[model samples]
Target: MNRHESMLRIAASSDISVLLLGESGSGKEVAARFVHAHSKRAGGPFIALNCGAIAKGLTESILEGHRKGAFTGAVDERLGVVRSADHGTLFLDEIGEMPFEIQCKLLRILQERAVMPLGSCDPQPVDFRLICATNRNLRAEVHAGRFREDLYFRLNVFPVKIPPLREREDFNTIAQEIWKEIADHNPLNASEIALLSKRKWPGNVRQLKNVLQRYSLLKPYDITLGNVLTDEFSEPATVADTCTLYQAKSRRIAETPEWNLICSELSKNSGNKSVTAQKLGISRGCLNYQIRKHSS
Candidate 1:
């Protein structure tokens, strides 16, 4: 977090195109928001779009507005995300997922400072800082020809890599923040939080948030090593009463609709948390919260 904070402070003062590189759940979007909030365009709108969520066919129309007659579904003229973020910041998440053709258009926009809407004759001038993020190895993508070389270099002007949760030494602090947000009646005890700090979370902060949510759902709504670690918890804590604690929290799992949906999705996905999170259009953190909420 310190590394990112320092980089964000340095990047926020400039209008340079910045790229955030990290794992999917490593908080790239959050870092982008930080940069924008502290930048010169802080008063302007911050428009964020997930490139991976948009299909190739609609990418251009989405980035640059379309006239009413541009396409089959076009009902009115609109300023797309780029123009909407004029004088502000435009954050493109999963930027590496953009198609080759769209990359050309994006490069053009960055270079020319203008965008031509679909079915429109005149190019509207635009001025906005661009912040792109991706979990992909973009340099490798350029080598493999999956991502454009020019576009990669353009967005890579100021790259900031966000470290994963396990690499950060402040897991306990992060866990406490999550606990405060999700805990119903009480916060996790210090010992329980200590135990949580000892292990690694592969999914990064998103997974930690999920795990912390589970801790909040323990039988009596208090956190414990067993509730967080379960059989999957690593580097077992020195606390010897975790077994009895686990048994106590196993009394009953809430049967809410959300809980049922979570179970159904997990079963359908064969319990693959990452896939399930993607299918649900949410982060693993959110999915974990959903699971712990009902399966307590």
Candidate 2:
């Protein structure tokens, strides 16, 4: 992680385009902001737009601006995202979701360092750092003919893949820092951090921070991390009414996936059933009950 941060710091020193690759909720935007904050354009505007959220048929106008009366909704002239980002940084999230037709327009802007707004024949010069992020594999998208190959190569100049939380070696340290930040410097005990570090944390740091936030709120009421986490993993609010509650839960456990998950947790905890139960966000008693029932 330190190495990755160093790489980002280096990338910030230049105007080269950057492409961040990571799973959803894995802090790609945070990384982008880090680069922007450290870059020479820190004083300039930082314009962010989610390509996936761009409304269809309005991509050009939204990205390159539009003159007054250019289209049905163009009641007034507007400086779009590209122009707004001039002399600063433009962060495009979910770049892989950008429509195919708009890709060529974006490539022209990158190649020419200017934008010609809709209904305008003259191109207005734009100078800004480009940082694009996406969870999708752009190479695969390009191969599938959904993404432009030329555009992918342009954005992939300094690609950096953000590692997921579960794969980070500093998970425990991260949890500690988040607790201190959210809980007014009152640190989580070592055991609490240990229990937290054992979970898969599928939602990555975002999910861990959320769990810590809840734990911080409940800490003043004399609650433990185990209690907070148990509540965190409680069953969904809605369930089928076709069977008894216990039967429904047991049925879930009897399924191959759920049973395999339990076994996997047990193995990961080195055969320590209690630790496995904590990692699975269930009481040790419940884990034992299910294990005994299913063992037969």
Candidate 3:
């Protein structure tokens, strides 16, 4: 881990573009933020945009800004994302998902250090450090003709590969850390931590955090972590027990920060279920379950 940090620091010392390669939910964005926080542009803005989340047909206007009256819906001028990070860092998450058409424009901007906004013939100078992250293999994408080879070479200047959580050597420490962050008032014992370390954690750290969040929520109701893990809470409940559980869940959902986070993310994603689920680090099914349970 120290070695990884040193490598990131070395990359951060210069203005070289960084390409973070990792599995989803493996903390690639966190790593990107760390680089931005440590870089010379740390004092400047750190703009993050999920390439996959950008609405279709709005890529150019969103990334390069737009002049007023550039399009049918253009009523106001915009600064766009690339210009927004001038003198700072721009983190592009899920860069692999960026459309092939926009890739060329991005490469041109990087080469020229300027952006040509929509409906503008003049190119405006811009200065910013770029950090891109993705779970897909750019080489494979390039071979598949889905990604541009020139762009891949340009962005892979300082490649950093973050390993999945299950492969990490410090699972226990990570689990304990997440538990502290999410359920500090209800610390896990050594045995519990060991049990966590033994699991596959297919969803990586994000999944572990979700498990801890569920445990914390159910603890006050005398629910055991084991039951939570096994989804035993879904078993049939007696009439009295059902009423109690319903009341408890209603109050918890109302007060728990995660519920509000869900609503906020859902709104931000324009109510796109797949995007919202991915952003929240939960499965689509899990998101649907929460909606069914709380949307009433």
lDDT (0 to 1) per candidate: 0.80, 0.83, 0.83
Cα displacement (angstroms), candidate 1, residue 167, comes to 1.3
For residue 155, model 2's alpha carbon misses the true position, in angstroms, by 0.6
lDDT of 2 by residue, 1-296 (tens): 47667779989999889999988888889999999999999999999999999987788888999999988889999999999999999999999999898889899999999999988999999999999999999989999999999999999999888889888877778888887788764577788878887787778889899988976654433355786676566665455632332353344333323778989899988989879977776666567656765887
Q: Model 2: residues >4 Å from true position, as ranges?
A: 233-296
**lDDT for model 2, on a 0 to 1 scale?**
0.83
lDDT of 1 by residue, 1-296 (tens): 48777998999989988999999798899899999999989999999998878777877788888999888989998889999999999999999998777889888998889999999999999989999999999999999988989888899999998988877766677777887888664666787777777776778888878876665555332344565576555556556755554554353233223556777888999999889877765556556666765667
Predictions: Cα RMSD each: 12.4, 12.8, 13.3
- Which residue pairs in candidate 2 collide? none
Q: Give per-residue CA lDDT, model 3, range 1-296, as digits (tens).
A: 65556788899889999999988888888888899888889999999999988886898888899999999999999989999999999999999999898899889989999988988999989999999999999999999999999999999999998878878887778787888888636468887876677777668878888989988766654455775665532557776675454464345434433878999999999999899987876556556667766966
Point out where model 3 deviates above 4 Å.
232-296
TM match of model 2 to true structure: 0.76
By lDDT rank, best first, the candidates go 2, 3, 1
TM-score, model 3 to reference = 0.76
